[model samples]
Target chain A: MSLAASPAPAFTLYDYVLSGNCYKIRLAAALLGVPYDSIAVDFYPGFEHRSEAMLALNPAGTLPVMKTADGVVLTETNAMLAWLGLNHDPGGRWYPAADPVRGPRLVEAMSFGAGLTGSVGLARLHAMLDWPVDGAAARRAGKRDLRQLELRLTAMQIDGEDWLAGGTAPSMADLACFPYVALSPDAGLDHDGYPAIRSWLYRVRSLPGFVTMPGIHDLHELR
Target chain B: MSLAASPAPAFTLYDYVLSGNCYKIRLAAALLGVPYDSIAVDFYPGFEHRSEAMLALNPAGTLPVMKTADGVVLTETNAMLAWLGLNHDPGGRWYPAADPVRGPRLVEAMSFGAGLTGSVGLARLHAMLDWPVDGAAARRAGKRDLRQLELRLTAMQIDGEDWLAGGTAPSMADLACFPYVALSPDAGLDHDGYPAIRSWLYRVRSLPGFVTMPGIHDLHELR
Candidate 1:
């Protein structure tokens, strides 16, 4: 991790080891080589995140809070990733730093990242763990969302853009969407059905600084 | 609706009047004084957003597609709002174009706008209109979501940030969250329990350039 010439920032990440939502920040941190401590939040310990301290850090009560040396608390995975990519990178190239031409596209990708990726995440939550998701109904929703994903992937392919919202360089949008798309099949989605999307996923996975989401079993395997 | 310096842009907004999601962009346009042509998308036509044309504009079939004059289409309400607020505004005060300190907080507020306001939208969809949400278990799901919404509102009150993120000046985050939170009671949520959120709603409504969402009874209401 490159220490800022000014001073080392007291950085820490509050994360759950198995969470891809948390993993997004970890991956960005690794890619950027930013040093930070990690504190695990036990979600299963009866809503431990609902505790007062966690709430103070994040009223949303979600994981992946990155505390800066100056004492600012950052929440929301994408928001944190955007900051690290924008603020820490020496090259200013991790994510497009807001171009007049492509800025809007970046935001579109993020909206899909949050909404579409969120749908896939919930579908998997129901599929694997038998959470509160309605059985067949959840799959129906997944199928619908998958169609949207396919169309989005196709448009990027058709738009002939090398990467999402920027050519040749990877942006935070790519990082934001990559994981959920990579694990689409776990939610009953078939990548074979969306060839362009499959290609896009491979492209994201092959990035020079890429990191995979803790290998699925890391949650059970790590500890 | 200010005229462009040259020919007008090819802007198309796939919007529903009562939707806070679409309102995000419209609010930005009003603040920036940009004229955009509105195309009413029928949500009741079995998720008309799933149509091929809409998908071509946005793979996720989301609303508020602001296509530029040169054929570049921008989706994602917040991103579109940010782009216009930054690029089109001469003063660039709407988004505070270059202040890194305030940017992330605004982005965080935008994310919270999505999930938090989205829950309110869901409540309206399920409780008020009694729409058959594709997930068959959605009825029960709605109540659970409402409980979560109450908690979120309570936390927002506790945080007590002046304008959703920080500072007295409002940004896209406040605009993004306005419609759904304002109309949440129409969906059966009692804001009487969340005094702070209730006040926040009024604060958003009081913004200088804010425009009310069109009435359903009016011909141009959906625009």
Candidate 2:
């Protein structure tokens, strides 16, 4: 055997296949080339995430719970993104929490993404899985958030920036917001009026090592 | 004249006096000794935060809008806290996003704090300002969050850690969650049920350079 140090320990992601929040972690790992072992959890009909055992692991009863190699259990999806970026990304551009100008914007965009999970994400769940939520309120809030996102993207496009945090390269901020926005059609909200958001979504999907979920798919060329 | 350079530029904070979210920024600035100009906006009777000018600054029309020295407008409270910690704290401990273990936990705590704003914060608004919201739902949610917070603090105390992120010195995570949790009494959620949370709150209040808002007060020693 060759004399070499052991490979870094892979993260254990307690994930659900249909969860956009779970997809956020998978997409971040793929883009950053970080390795993780995903244990599929039945989130929909099974409601396994809310099971006693899962609640013991994460009191929040949320999907995409990440247990690090060091055994630190992270319940928030954005936290998982931050951990992946800070620990795995060699270029240090994915998180950029150190840069004064970009850091706050990054945090803002990530927070906005989390808000989208409440709005767009909830609406999508109501539509797709027949979840008992105020669908009308969720849709209204989703529309408002989508409009805000479009306006921000339009401003960025006008200012000659490509990503959410206005950095030359995409950061965790982009990944944080991408999944739900891309999956908005499931909520009966389309990108017809959001040209800027459409363009931005395309840009995110075009990134190297980009992955796809059940709702969001890769663009395929016609044979 | 001495050859010293000009002082760092001060940030402009669009604030509301009674807002726990706004107090978060004020408290962070005080703790970090970061100077900033506060522009008071009547969030309650005046509804000044939703005014057109404020909307122009932040489309979200959120209180605690922060205009940085470099002219970047930040609307999220947690973002402002991250900015203050990352840019102002010389010790590098307040926002330790570089440390993989602490970083994810910090993000998790911060997100939890944001959620408390929705639960505890909304409940407080409904109770104090008579905001048109489902007070019962808000209180129920707030109680659940407070219980979860108490459990987390209890676990941290068992681990011999004082702060939310389980760090020796308190990080931004503590500050992010402090305001809403401290102000939960305004929502009729008392600290009598949460001994660990009450102890943690006292510790945060006792920190050097601690500041207070309307509902929260300084522990004055009587003769």
Candidate 3:
């Protein structure tokens, strides 16, 4: 028999399964054990994300927008990640900014996610969608972002750490940055030169209850 | 008398006076009473942000990078806003995400900051910095963002909420969105069609410790 309980976790994800932003929410729920409904939008050539129905959900046309059973909708992927980490993670490994020691590093990692990581996603969009863009510059910027992550991860490994936030465990930092970096090859960019990041990608893939999308597989690129 | 026990707040902001991103940090420090040294970076004609010294500080070349006396550095503007909100705001007004009732609204606001408001900033960069870009697309996108904010805030006013996050007071959400919206005209856009956003801008300028950049004044567009 089902026990009488509190309010249900009613989540409806406005998902474009192939979109990394949408995949982020899916992965977050999988890792955190938050269950939800998924509404697949025609994001690619169909461009349903910009349709009137989608605009009613998120006026700016950004996606992975979600509506809680209670009617709270969120559009920014990183913001959604932060919310899941803060509100759901009992182990406190995902949203470690509450920890004084790990806080600053987490902020830095977040900065990287909000700004530098966008380049990689944009480049990927250009490569996959036939979207007109300066592919070379976007790839260059994406490469720079990868190298930056590689440099930091290299140092973390030397110090006996595995996560991006200088903590022993993964935080929203890793989750926010992982998908695009792993899928960078689809944008004609690769991390062959960055061994540390390759290993870190492997580690993310190894997270308990991890999920995957069309472009990237759940496999370790390095040992 | 100076405190003998605890360390002083030694914060230095690597600033570009004309940049709304850098202005964001300056505004935060001012509102919070966090004193900082302003190290003006020759961001414009000189392109010092790409210089070797600047690159050493932030490899991605984004500005408003701040260094605390204890040697902590921050590069992303929104990330820095979140940091200040979490660490320095004992008052709890500026960072309402800590409050459970307001948390979801704050997340929605954070979404706006990370994604939609970026169009205005990018448009501004194109207009003022002699940067070649798709001015039409950027301005179109930026206008759409402004209209979106206006619709929300207008409805909020009818509901008697003045702040972006539906709180009684300004939160990180308000501050994160204010600079770019108020500075929209520099990018060849305006709020003539968005009276609610104009009033909102006025309300922000009217904050107790509010400071002003070069273009936007400390006066209400409405009154």
Candidate 4:
């Protein structure tokens, strides 16, 4: 893995490795070539995210709380990705949307990311984290979401586009939707039907400086 | 209802009157004094939102689909709110706070809104729309979400702020999080514990050009 060049990145992310939300942040930082300290929060059995210190940091008790160098604390992983894309990337490469159009589309993807996280991601929790989710309901929802995503990707491909929001550049739209989707199998979602989405995942992994979690295979490392 | 001055807003919102997501668009447009044509999409037993036309508009089969003057279509309510705030409000009054901070905070609120929608909003659907949600679990999660909102609002109020994300003026974050929260009672969540959020909702209603849905009573009308 590529490391930060000079002084340590002033970002500190309170994270849980198994969390897709947390993974998005790590992915963004890795892609940006920025390094941040990761303090693992035991989200599964221990559920330390609800502890006093964690709640004091973010009352919502959500994982992947990020403390920027300026001491500004933020929860919501996609928001952190957005802040990093907007502030840290001087070239604005990660957020290549031209606005009014691409911007709203990115927002749409982020919102869908939320739905996918709740359904597919929640379904995964039942298996790996001992969290009991409504199996049938979550599976149904996850399948529906996959179809929707596949449909969008198919349309984008028809339009001769590869990325989700931006034209040629991969944006937060891609990152926000990636982890849980790549990990949807843990949720019992069959991947055989989503060819376009699978291809898109490969493209995301092949980006210049991509990273990976346990379930998300790093394309470079595999090859 | 205030209508837009001549040369109509080229916006078209496919909405359901009872939908909080749809109400968010009405609220934003009302607050902005921008008028749009509303095309009601029967979301209840009819489920026309999933019809071929609606699916063509938004493959996600979600409501509050918006067709902008530029013909760009959007489905997510909060994204529509953000798009309207970013584009329509030339003064940037609705998208307050500097980037890198307020932006992330707004995103956090939007994500929290998603949770609240699933919890409190889902509870309401069981009654109004005959949607069979997990009642006990939803109520429990709804109450927890309310408490979290209460805590955040209390902190923001103590910080001498009335709105959710911005310093003083109401922003899209407030609008995005407001509808379902104000209408939580329909979901069997008691309002007694969330005084700060309650007061904050009133402040939102008191804003100039504020609009209301069925359950969300207008403060001005009450007095």
Candidate 5:
């Protein structure tokens, strides 16, 4: 389960250890058993992601920039997730982009995950790193978003659906959303108010090959 | 190219005539020649999109909700575009979600387009409908986004690619981004400074079945 560098990996990820977005790629690669090389960047104190070299790789100056062995660069986290799912998973369950019903739903959940980035993600950055964002506004938005997510998760639970896109197996949608929602406590938004989200987070962590990030830990061995 | 109601349309689109997000759906349907019934919701002044009825359909309270005849509802515009492209377009050029290379790029551009909804789209809403957003901040972000788009478009043009995802034909990426960038003038961001964006807009408008919204117009008959 170790992500130690392979002699020759398929992808190279420019990652930040504390970033949920970056952890998403790492966790997805781990769960799918896809090997990749990781080059750590200091996003907080160093702001290396915004440096000229990083910007050359990803003009958006975002973390979790992924480059394939063939020189294809992916700057968006969801896009990177899609690429990993579509290319690596032999069973095609991870992406399922060709499934007419599930594909759009997957895309929908992925977009919702990006919304979480602006809300919970921003609030976390502000709280942890004192990033120059409107912390109060971000927390407000994050609370609203978490509430909405809880409602959806409750509905899905009622419908007997275990995944966000209502598929038998978790897709990129789950991977896209898992990190931020799992890390919401760092933003001062605790899971006590979101039972369904807590359950979903537990299920995600219980998955085989699940990896841990700074704020989110792997499930206890006894559990 | 007329979008007049069919006796039995395959889908129903909850629409707002002036909304750039809604236009993204209408334009995608038109480009793919997919027939749909339009249910207009008064977004401005009325805020019908937030009304109880629309809330029952889309809790997100966003315009451009699409329901398939089979009763599948798509709340995200990019997801709706993906559904239309994946389901309607026989050639599959519009989605290309199965392509290892193009699929990721398409998702990346689509994500970028959603960012436009925050920047250019918010600024436009502030200017046109006085939506009570931070017009100044929205404008600043809009300018930055437009500049980034221009740089990418310039690079694409240099590489002899006509579309956003670097595909031979336009994909959902192009449609997802076309509306906001085309409507940037409403936000006080003109195309005079971005030659590459201007050309890309022209190319998009020149597509065979391009439709027009309030702020965007079709090419003249002579053209």
Candidate 6:
């Protein structure tokens, strides 16, 4: 049945199976019960995304572009999350539409997650693959980022809330951060020094419909 | 005296007089006419953000924390903009509540804006002060970022849109990138190569209630 005839727009995700960034959008869609089709982009082979067809979808050359039946394509996980929260979850649990108070905190987390978490993830991925970056440099950068991550995580605990921010329910802040925060060790950074971060990771992972990032190879299995 | 008595909550912004980051928030508040109080933080002599009192306001130790009437402290420029757009401007102008189609494109602009712009800003500041960074190395980085930014601007030109993304009116994407985009000359980068960016800067600079950054000295003017 065409979603156009129905009340909601049909959803489709142009994604790479293992990307944490892609997973963030997919998890949100699944939790919201928004039916979406996933089309794979083989980043390793540089196949689909570089083709002229994919370029037409997103010029930024990134994965996980979400297409809506209304002929709209949503890219960028954080922005997509914001749109989904506003449109789908009217009650505002996934996103607090009314809470201007929590807005900056959530935005900071998402920005930090996208940047710092990304830096750490890259260093870790290079280490896992024994790539070009020297082991010592990778570890040093990982530790530096972890220290900052710990500072933010400690703040989360001091706020005395179960989630990263002070909301009774976890908003995008918690979701934006925890995925990579938990996986930092896999990238060769130690999390033992940050117990609060470890606990927060556990809390997020324990959430219903929580899907782990498929390792670099097992992406197909998860999808 | 309080906004609790009214429908919309009163907005207040805690700012450091000289920080460009803080300027983005103030600019947003001014354009929205949300009526905010500006609380100033002293960034002189040493890093004021590391101070205990400041930490209490924002654990991340960043400025431009917005306190809503209900007393919630919103941190980060992009996040605060998102909240304000959703809460105050239902008109879909400053923050565009309904344009999911352009969501990802806007996020990409903002992300590129935050990271690349911040880096270029720092490089310029360092160059202006005759700081220690290798000139060639820094220029290489600045140029790399400029290439990415140029591509984005070119694409915006193709969309035949004046703003970065979503809605006929400019939103956070434009504001988020405007500060550094306008100041590219300071980084020894040339904007003459990018016609759309030049036009976009004019558009942003002409916004109602637009305020310039307090430079590197008078950041406390808001106080």
Deviation in Å, model 3, residue A121 alpha carbon = 2.3
lDDT of 2 by residue, A1-223 (tens): 9888756757999999889999999999889887778899989789999999999999889888999888888889999999998889888889888787788789899999999999999999999988899999999999999999999999888889999877689999999999999999999999999999988988898898998988786866301
Q: How accurate is candidate 4 locally (lDDT)?
A: 0.81
How displaced is residue B146 in candidate 6, in Å? Answer: 4.6
Of 1 and 2, the candidate ranking higher by TM-score: 2
DockQ of 6: 0.38
**What DockQ do the predictions score, one after another?**
0.44, 0.80, 0.37, 0.51, 0.80, 0.38
Clash pairs for candidate 5: none
lDDT score, candidate 5, position A27: 92
Tens digits of per-residue lDDT for model 6, A52-136: 8887887667776877666666667777776676667656677653354555466667787776544666776676655566567
lDDT, candidate 2, B96-128, per-residue tens: 876777888888899999998899999999999
* Runs in model 2 lying further than 4 Å from the true structure: A1-9, A221-223, B1-9, B221-223
* lDDT string, candidate 5, A1-223, tens digits: 9886645687999999999899989999999998888899988798899999998888889898999989888889998998998788888888988788888988999999988999999999999989999999999999998999899999888878989878668988999899999898999999998989989998899899998987886689427
Query: Which pairs, if any, clash in model 4?
Result: none
Better of 2 and 3 by DockQ: 2
lDDT of each: 0.67, 0.89, 0.78, 0.81, 0.89, 0.67
Estimate the TM-score for candidate 5.
Answer: 0.95
Q: What's the lDDT of the predicted structure labeled candidate 6?
A: 0.67
Model 6 residue A14 CA deviation in Å:
3.5
Which structure is stronger by TM-score: 2 or 4?
2
Q: If ranked by lDDT, best first, what sequence of candidates would result?
A: 5, 2, 4, 3, 6, 1
Model number 5 iRMSD: 0.8
Q: Residue B116's C-alpha lDDT in candidate 6?
A: 56
